[model samples]
Target: MPPPHSLLQLIWLASPALPVGGFSYSEGIEAAVEWTGLDSEANAAEWLSDQLHLSFARGDLALAAQAITAWRAGDAQRIRTLNDWVLHTRESAEFLLQTEQMGRSFVEWLKLHHADTAEVFAGLPATYPVAFAFAASRTGASVHDGCLAFAFGWAENMVAAAVKAVPLGQSAGQRILARLANEIPAAVDRAMQLTDDERQAFAPLLAVLSARHETQYSRLFRS
Candidate 1:
């Protein structure tokens, strides 16, 4: 199949090579693995699939869909509102740091490589989801397509984290990612259908895990 005009850019935005420091965050997965004995490929896959469906696909990606639409329509106040929601809903300091830093990093990436577009964000807080929405609005993909890219990027980074944290093999990590890929499209579809009121960062155990990770005796990932 031929790439769309912005497919390559979509792919780039989703790439682990984007220098957003996404490499440093496990989003509580590391701590969960340590505390919960998520030591096998199957265990890792199950945990991630649950996270995809329960948290990310519903919450972050939904906001991304809204933010993307707002950005495309040049709605600055809507963007700020979404950004504030992300900040206020963070369940832990580590989680908050993870999103904010990645957001700032993504924004800086936009500024360096796509200045004209980044200029729209000069005065806005670009939390990861919102910054992602801002950058993804330029992709020209349907919102679902853009959400798919976001989901895959998240799965890839997360699989890498599982490999290191769970100490799984490369093949095990690949298997976990494969399972996540199978679930992502449906998750993205569900995300696309959500209203702003339904979006929430409401994972209780995940929050506890993330807070514990902040002072974890020894840790590889930041959150």
Candidate 2:
């Protein structure tokens, strides 16, 4: 470990306000609300929490851990393979754009900090998950810690969206976040053992919702 408080450094690894442009996208929550009957703040929160466990948190974090392991081993080829898989598997055009935009933006900032590090790309060829993993691993965060932080960030983002979309009280949004804390550990456990071949998840519901959001009358977030 780098030091007693080295874990704090991981905070920088996945900062929501980083140049990665994360706030510009709502990770399909907007679509889920518009298409499904998940219109209320409470319903949106529930849907997002379930999604955090079943799909986004599980699939992305696993790939991130794998990328971190490969990066640590100095296996550039494996890292590239992980990147390629993300490129192929993130089927939605909007979703792919979100990941690639965030990944490239993250790489731009990361290279500023990790210059001279082997294979550090000026533009990340890896997906957002892998980029996040590499950044956290480089900063001495444990794989579990990294994954949880990643999930927490997205969870919080959904809460923000609920606050905007449903006229939910700020306190209610915080309560939703507190509720997610209880569920994250079980999801993290599943993410740790997730295999690349098992990356496909039944999240087509969100995809369909997102496609519909493009035509929805009004929305709080970009799909």
Task: Using lDDT, give the best candidate's number.
Answer: 1
lDDT, each prediction: 0.87, 0.73
Candidate 1 accuracy as TM-score? 0.96
Residues 117-183, candidate 2: write the lDDT tens digits: 3366634475677777778777666777777777777677667776676657888888888888778
- Give residue 30's lDDT in candidate 1 (0 to 100): 88
lDDT (Cα) of model 1: 0.87
Per-model TM-score on C-alpha atoms: 0.96, 0.89
Which candidate comes out best when scored by TM-score?
1
Q: Which runs of model 1 end up more than 4 angstroms from their true locations?
A: 1-3
lDDT of 2 at 78: 84
Instruction: Write the residue-wise lDDT of candidate 1 on 1-223 in tens digits.
Output: 2257678878888898889999889988889887998888888889999999999987898898888899889888888999999999999999899889999988888887676855677777679989888788887787777788888999999999999998899998888888888899899889988898788889999999999998899999989
